[model samples]
Target chain A: MEIFGIPAQALYGQLALGLVNGAFYALLSLGLAIIFGLLNLINFAHGAQYMLGAYVAWMLLSYLGIGFWGALVVAPLVVAVLGMALERGLLRYLRDVDQIYGLLLTFGVALILEGLVAQSYGWSGMPYANPLPGSVDLGFMRMPMYRLVAIAISLVVCLAVWIAIERTKLGAYLRAASEDADMVQAFGVNIPRLIMLTYGFGVGLAGLAGVVAAPVYQVSPAMGSNLIIVVFAVVVIGGMGSIAGSVIAGFGLGLIEGLTKVFYPAASTTVIFFIMILILIFRPSGLFGSTR
Target chain B: MTADTAMLSVRDLHAWYGESHVLHGMTLHVGRGEVVTLLGRNGAGKSTTMRAIMGLMKKRSGSITYEERETITLPPHRIARMGIAYCPEHRGIFSRLDVQENLELPPVIGADPLTLDRVQAMFPRLVERRHSPGTKLSGGEQQMLAIARILRTGARFLLLDEPTEGLAPIIVKQLGEIIASLRTIGFTILLVEQNFRFASGFADRHYVVEHGRVVDEIAAGDLAAGSERIRAYLGV
Candidate 1:
């Protein structure tokens, strides 16, 4: 059955793939949003951190015979610890300098990680076995259980972060620190510790996204490279001010990307960028971003 | 140095900004629950003295002891946590946040915090604009909110820079009344004022600063008889 000059099966297939990709998009963009929200750092090394997460999961599974579930639990934690070390050791010293320096420093770190990963793993792709073995039968179509699980887990984690930041007392401190860091420090909240922890949390989210992506996407140094650009587009579409905006924009853009592939496969790759440009023209702050 | 006794004590503090020397061995002290003012003409570095004491800028040298703890090497945020709140000449309210959120920022430290209702009682205008963004407030209202915001932190000592500057007469009177009331509540105040009339009304003692240094100290009662001293130093 064809609809809008495209086959229904192909459209649904793309939609499923889009939703899977959207899971990664949502996770990565959420991480980026946290970094931007709290530290006001662009965190150019986020993609490298994501790649490191995948590598860590792969190594753990290959060497220690770790199960998919075990790698999932451990990878993000490792990345987060490493991120803390980075923040405490390097990023801390650059606080008094112009913020552009932070971006540049992170970019340099990204280059170093990418070069190291490329040298060790080679530019070739590494395969990772699907954690969940079988596909689940849906009323309309057969769905891959692993992909569905990926989307489900991503949603759960994102929701947990949203709740922690939006509903909890800790969230209140984080929001306050982001608004007036000096004032929060005056309240004796230990501003530097908060900054470091938030950085780790943001990096941890990227690692989790990478861990989830390992089965579907080849674990390569370039895995997070191209995906990060799309995630940035998602962030722009969603306002940086709110986490809910980032999540909605991420998933919505993924669906739009899926639909474009079904109707006009040629335009699929360019659609995200096109939307970003349009958004910049129509709403400069973004859909959910505040003008102030 | 006890929390219940001396609020802040600056002893022989010397500070400089890069090559320019400021605060040349100036010493002042504010007791608990006292209102003291640092008054001077333009370019006298009254604001610089405030900034140096608050640790907001790079200093050549100075020892600022708040509650008896030496704060010369402490960061601005750490200094603020020692119960010394500074209201800069340009207010530091988070403009994007609502008035309530702005007020809510100060109590994150687990201090003996003040409630919104208490602050609202002090500045009713803030209560009315509790939901409005801080940037949307009028100049006088913003000043009140700024002062009230610091008070909510339960700060024992406040260093306010030009609170009544550029305000209308009615607002100025209201501010004077608020300051009087705040003092009655046992909050010590260190005010920097360009307006002599405004400072004289609230300050019990005056330290006249000239060229980043305190040249004279006089009690409030003797200000009228000390017109020559004021003209020679303050040019009022």
Candidate 2:
């Protein structure tokens, strides 16, 4: 059997790779979408928070001799707490200011975090031991067991978060706050507290993604910066503030990128931007985003 | 304030948006099961007064009492949980959410949750368009959905700003009927309206506001005798 002028085995291999990449993309963009939706702020610091997750994990394992499994739980929580602190202390002050000020403040935070990590560890990447630590043999091809674990974990986390926001009673208030904060508050839901929780949750998602990606990619300060641009491209393709759109766009773009690498490796880098341009011309609100 | 008589009471309430003062030392009381209207021309601080009562606007200075308890410093959601719902001048409906979804929002946090059937019974149009997104509804339908959404929150006190604004005449008549029904159900309303005609039908008494202060107070039955006061303040 042949697919896209490639052998079936090769196609399947790339599909697996695509799925893994897509999982991370979906996770990162989901947090971005949530923060943007609820707070109406483009969190430029999201990628930094993601890196902080990796750093925390690395620190836990290296200095304290903790393992990957422990860091997975600890790192994201720590990052989320840090996010809450930032929201309560700094972001809260910018609430009445123009929304652009939020963007600027987060961007500054991103730079500071990136700079701190670089100063501490230098530009070299750190190695993290794979928690699952094995390979699984597929009939068509042999694959790393950890890759599948990462994929499964990311998918589960993504679905859990999506369900939490879309299906629960708390989600109702969240949706209302995103749409009309003042009205939601008037109804007696604490808008400020909602804002803080949303920020923390979004940051927590980024941290989780980082912990999962530490094994696949090099753990370094530059890790989040590299992914940040592509994630922004994914967000634009998905549409601003659309939860389902961000998730679908993240995975879809990753699959497209993987296919491009196999068929036309040179075009792989620019394919997401090409899709963004097409989306802007056709459905600017994104595949699932409402025009409003 | 009578025990269990007042739903929301504001005394010497002052609010500001940045450097501009919107409500200046305003005092108003909304009795339980009463429909009260604040009648004024545009920019009379009617909306600000409602927001202050709900604590939506930050940096508020003054006293707000709800259920005979001070609520001046409480957050908006806490105010909402206390059974006060605000429908803004723009009709703060979640446009992306469907009609049922919009109604589903309020009861999620409200003290006493009203069911879909209950709110739909109050505003039938909302039930008919329950599957439709809020933006798809007509102005009247959206208005009905907005009011129903608040009612679903079990809000004993309703702050509705210009519910009939920009609506068709037929819809305005429908709104009047709905307001009448709500009043019958023992709902206390704080209605902000520029159209005296629409307001006079439901409000027992009206407060005339001018340039951020209450300039005149008149009973709805005596609006004819108070026409000169209305003309001077409302310029209508």
Candidate 3:
């Protein structure tokens, strides 16, 4: 059978690949949304942090002889500590300043991190050994076991984060702090500490996405730089601080991009940006953003 | 007033928002278990006084002694932890959260915190709409949630700013009753109100503020005799 001039088998294959890419998009954008929502500062260094996650994982394996499973546990924690220090030492000072300064500062930090990694690893990508090495056939298409695992894990992580923020008392404090920090502080929550932890948690999510992406894609310093632009476009389409919106838009856009590749191969690269533009023109706040 | 006797005492408190000086030599005191009101017209620095006392203002000077401890330089959170709670003029309810979530959001500080059931029983209307988000609540309900949320913190001193602003007369009456009940429960209240009549009944003593300074004070018993002067001062 064929649909829209494409064979069903080929279509299914593309859809599976799209879902894999969507998993990454969803994870990365979710981090961006969380950081932006609470801290009210755009973290331009998120892509670098994602790259750092992959690098930390690579360092663990190459130097310390730690395997993928260990890297999965160790890498995000390392990145989270680094992120917390960055927030405490630098971002905390900029809290009272203009938002643009924060963007510029983070952009500078990203450039510094990327430049350092390039000096050490070089621009060329490094190969990562896939921990889950197998394929599962769903009749219409054969999906790689690792890719399936990535999709399932990403979904679980996203759902867990959603539940933590929506249903828990800590989540309520975070949501309230985002709305009015002073009021939350008046209620005796050390808001500055919360803000610091929030930034750390957000960047840690990016790091987690990095660890997941390392095996699927080549682990390179430039890997995050390549993926982050697309992720930003995804966030814009989803709505800036909307968590659910980020998850849905991330996966949906990935699938759409996958379908585009099958129909119009050349348009796949630009498809997300085009959709973002269209969404912005109609719904200025994006799909799920409340008017601020 | 001596700082030892008062629950909260501010002496020559001056504060600023950036370069624009707002609170100038504002002094006030609230005794333990007394409901005091700061009555003033718009731009009279009533709100600034409240913000300064809560340590929300960036630049502040002079002695803000709470429980005999100097708190003028303390951060808002630290000051709050010392058993002082502030409900801003805007009510400061988190519209994104449900009423129950909003009430439960604040960390319970100190001892003798009001339980959720106690708060709910105090405002049965809040219990009925606990699941509703703050934005969906009526003005009076939001105000009740705001006050109730702070009451959960076990903060003995409550700073209420214009709680009745923009509420209907009936709602204002309801809020007044809640405030009166809070007093009966022994909460020390420092209230700021534009509605002179609404505050006059509840407050034990009234301080008149003008240009960030306390210019006149009227005890509750003297309210009737000082009405003409207060009307002239408040222009109400």
Candidate 4:
């Protein structure tokens, strides 16, 4: 049967693909929101860190005979340590400066990381054989098992993160620190150490997204650079530092884009940007964002 | 006056906010378990003394030795961990954090911490406002919350900057009684008070600050005799 002049199979297929894409956007933007919120730094190296995640995973599998499961555990840890080093060695020095300097530093880091990887791996791409090769048949469409796993995992992680930041004691410190870090410092909390750990955690989230994307998307340097813009658009529309907003907007926008593709294929690519522009006009802080 | 029993000693403590010098050799001391007051007007460097002692000022110099340990060069967190808690002039109640969260956010650092239950009991008004956002509280409630938050840190010394400002008379009385109780239990407090009469009722001594230094000193016993002199300093 056809739904709105399109076969159910094709329509459901596009929706599933969009959700898988949304999975990555949700993870990446969630990290962006976190780093931006606590550190007060716009981490432009987020895309490079995402690429590093995929590269670390690829190296694990190709060089050490580690599988996807092993890479899943190891990649984020490695990247988190690297992220902590970056914060300690570089970013912390610029903490008291204006936000623009932090943004530019991260931008430089992203360029250097991407450049090094491209020089080594070649700019074209590297293919990663899908680990979960089988597909499950639904009433409307047959969905790949890996894509389903990815969607489910991303949603669960996004929820877990939201809880961690909103419901826990450590979360209270984080929220309070974002509001008045100087007060938190005077209250006996080691703010500099906390900032470093938070930056690592956010970078680790991006790394986790990259590892998850390797088997489905091309395991290449440009892979993250190609997708970061869309993920940023999702962050902007959702609200720059709102965790729930970013998560919801990530998946919500993906599904909306999916619907647009089915209806007007020409506007699918530009639809999120159009919505972002509209949000900027009416609510410059973005939907769900407060003045904070 | 003597460093022998002083829990906090400031010798020629000076600090700067960028190029503008704020604290100019501000010298003071709070004896163990003594309630001392820094009495001054708006631009008299009272708050800057608190900040400098707590290591919050970026350009603080001269000697600040707390518990006989030199803290002039220590970072704010280090000074805080050394058992000195600073409740800022503005109260610093985060709008985003609920009352309970704000109370619980400051980590309990040292021994003999005031349990949350004890704090809640002390400030009975906070019990009902536990779930409300911190800024949702009334002025008196926010001040009580800030004081309560620092108590949980187990700090033996407290730096309270203008806690009675913008507060009701009843709240001020309650805070005065709490300070009396704190002193009885061996807690040293260095308070900055714009309300001279309220502080005179509780302080063991008063340090009269002007510009950025302590220009005069008055013992609690001699307050009545120096009442006119103190009033002149306060410009009241």
Q: Tell me, by TM-score, which candidate is best.
A: 3
On residues B93-180, what C-alpha lDDT tens digit does candidate 1 reach at each position? Answer: 7664678767666653326756767888878878889989877898898898888888777777888999988889999999898888
Q: Categorize the docking of model 2.
A: medium
Worst 10 residues of 1 chain B by lDDT: B105-114
The CA lDDT at A145 in model 2 is: 95
Candidate 3, DockQ to 2 decimals? 0.87
Q: Give per-residue CA lDDT, model 2, range A206-237, as digits (tens).
A: 99999999989989998998898889889988
Compute each candidate's TM-score over C-alphas.
Answer: 0.88, 0.90, 0.98, 0.97
Question: In candidate 4, what are the lDDT values of residues A17-82, reduced to their tens digit?
Answer: 889888889999999998888898888899999999999999999999898889988998899999
Q: Which stretches of candidate 3 lie above 4 Å from their native place?
A: none
Task: Rank candidates, DockQ, best first.
Answer: 4, 3, 2, 1
- lDDT (C-alpha) at residue A143 in model 4: 89
Off by over 4 Å in 4: none
lDDT of 4 by residue, B1-236 (tens): 79777889999988999899998898888898899999988999999999888888989889999889999988899999999998999999999789988888888888989888888899888888899999999999999999998998899999999999998899899988988888887889999998988988888999999999999999999988878888998889
| Cα deviation of B69, candidate 4, in Å | 0.5
The complex in candidate 4 yields a DockQ of: 0.88
i-RMSD per candidate, Å: 3.0, 2.0, 0.8, 0.8
Model 2 CA deviation exceeding 4 Å by range: A1-9, A63-66, A277-284, B1-8, B107-117, B227-233
Instruction: Compose the digit string of candidate 3's lDDT tens values, residues B1-236.
Output: 45569888899999999999988899888899999999888999999999888888989999999989999888899999999998999999888899889888878787998888988898899889989988799888888888988998899999999999999999999899999999999999999998989988778999999999999999999977878879999886
lDDT of 1 at A143: 86
Candidate 1 residue-wise lDDT at B218: 79
**Clash count for each candidate, listed in order shown:** 2, 5, 0, 0
TM-score of 4: 0.97
